[model samples]
Target: MSNVFDGYERQYCELSANLTKKCTAATALNGEQKKQKVSEVKAGLDEAEALIRKMDLEARSLQPNIRAVLLAKLREYKSDLNNLKNEVKKIVSGNINPSARDELLESGMADALTASADQKTRLMTSTDRLNKTSDRVKDSRRTMLETEELGVSILHDLHSQRQSLLHAHNTLHGVDDNIGKSKKILTNISRRMNRNKWIISSIVLALVVAIALILYFKLSK
Candidate 1:
């Protein structure tokens, strides 16, 4: 079964190569020869297209798993066939020389193929930038989350410290009240000591004067 498909592929390749040669030879041809070559290439094209259809049908007869790979190859052949058709079309329409025709076709094909590659490259670049942006956004969000957590912790510690400070302030206020009461007691004691000293000094002076008068009177008598 696979051998049959292989045979078809081989035939198609040979025919395609021959058609390419004919198309090339047609560029140097003129008069009836060019028309004859073009007609022959057209007939070959139709036959090649028929082979492709046959290959398609044969690939379908294959096992489901094998069919996929063969189908893929068939698609490539189909594309190749289309490209050949375009070449013949160019040869027919432009009636230009071979070398110029090749260059023109190559230039056009290059532009088409290059456009696809350029688009892919641009898409990859955009995707890379988007991925980087996503990473940066994730990092920023994580940082913000950590900062928020740290802020909450710091606030909690500050609140605890404030409570401790309030407790200490209350304790110090009680001590200050005790100190004030003690200071007032000391002031009252100091005032009483000063008054007692003045009273004792006056009593001592009065005793001395009374004794001196008694002594003077006794001596005179």
Candidate 2:
């Protein structure tokens, strides 16, 4: 199992190296390099595809699981080849389209391939943007939920505080009423004591007058 994976890895590395070399050649070429590098790239792609097919065939003979995996990989390689071919066609059509300059001039298979490649690129870009927007929306929604929770918590706390304040106010009002009643009672007691003192003073004055009158009458007798 591991050996097959290792083989696939080696093949993948080789294919990557070959593509890189071809691309480098394409870059280095002035005019003739384009044709040569293009041909080389195509040939490399074809060889890689053939290798993938052969590997898939061998893997299929071994086991069902291996077959499935290898077949999937083989399909991927083929898809890559098709994509590269389309890209190459796009490049070719770009050159032809400018010179032909006729809208009715139906482009060849290469042109159609180029259009397909362009459409695929646009689709991929659109998909990426949509995914990004979706992720952002999810994040925003999560933040909003957190904010809503915070708001609910704050409201709960405020409600508790309000209840406590109301309870405290009611308790204070009861205490104030009790204090006012006590003050009124004290005032009434003070008023009663003042009235009793005044009454006692009047009685003493009356007794002194009575004593004086009795003395006068005895003297007279």
Candidate 3:
């Protein structure tokens, strides 16, 4: 009958709309919205099943071609419902949505990249500080070396001055010894001249006394 066919078409259109809503709910809806959508989908599926059963009973009274088309549509709808049920099961089992998973991955990768860049910056700063410390050490070593060289030069100058002072001291000691010997020689010459003068005066006095005694004896005779 025309009314029976029209009822079947309307039921098919309703079931298709319910399937679209269920798919959208499974993929897009969340929280209370998702729960409400799932309840609606389950009720729709039950109604569709009931409608199919009624159509199947009436289908036997139709033409063979009409019955075949209805049977095919029923089988297709049943298959789709079974597949959607499996999809819901997977969703309930905690399978992550692809879009959400991609977003989380991108955020994690950005954090990792930022952490790596900070580590690199810290390493470079440490390296620069180490280089500065090394340069300071090198400058200190060079300054120490220069100081050592200066110490050696001062020691050499001190040694030369000490040698010159020793030579001058030896020369002064030699001059003092020569002057002491010259003074002793002058004292010996003055004592010899005084002894010679005393001998000459004694000889002159003895000669004058002998001549006076000889003249007195002649006068007495």
Best candidate, TM-score-wise? 2
TM-scores of the models, in the order given:
0.45, 0.48, 0.41
The sequence of per-residue lDDT tens digits that candidate 3 reaches over residues 119-210 is 46644655565678779889999999999999999999999999999999999999999899988888888788788778887787777788
Give me the runs in candidate 2 sitting further than 4 Å from their true place.
1-108, 211-221
lDDT of each: 0.80, 0.65, 0.67
Identify the runs in model 1 with alpha carbons over 4 angstroms from their true place: 95-99, 102-221
For candidate 3, the per-residue lDDT at 65 reads 84
In TM-score terms, candidate 2 sits at 0.48
Ranking by lDDT: 1, 3, 2
Between which residue pairs do clashes occur in model 3?
none
Cα distance off (Å), candidate 3, residue 78: 63
Off by over 4 Å in 3: 1-112, 200-221
Q: Which residue pairs overlap in candidate 1's backbone?
A: none
The C-alpha RMSD in Å for every predicted model, in order, reads 19.4, 15.6, 34.4
Model 2 Cα RMSD, 1 decimal: 15.6
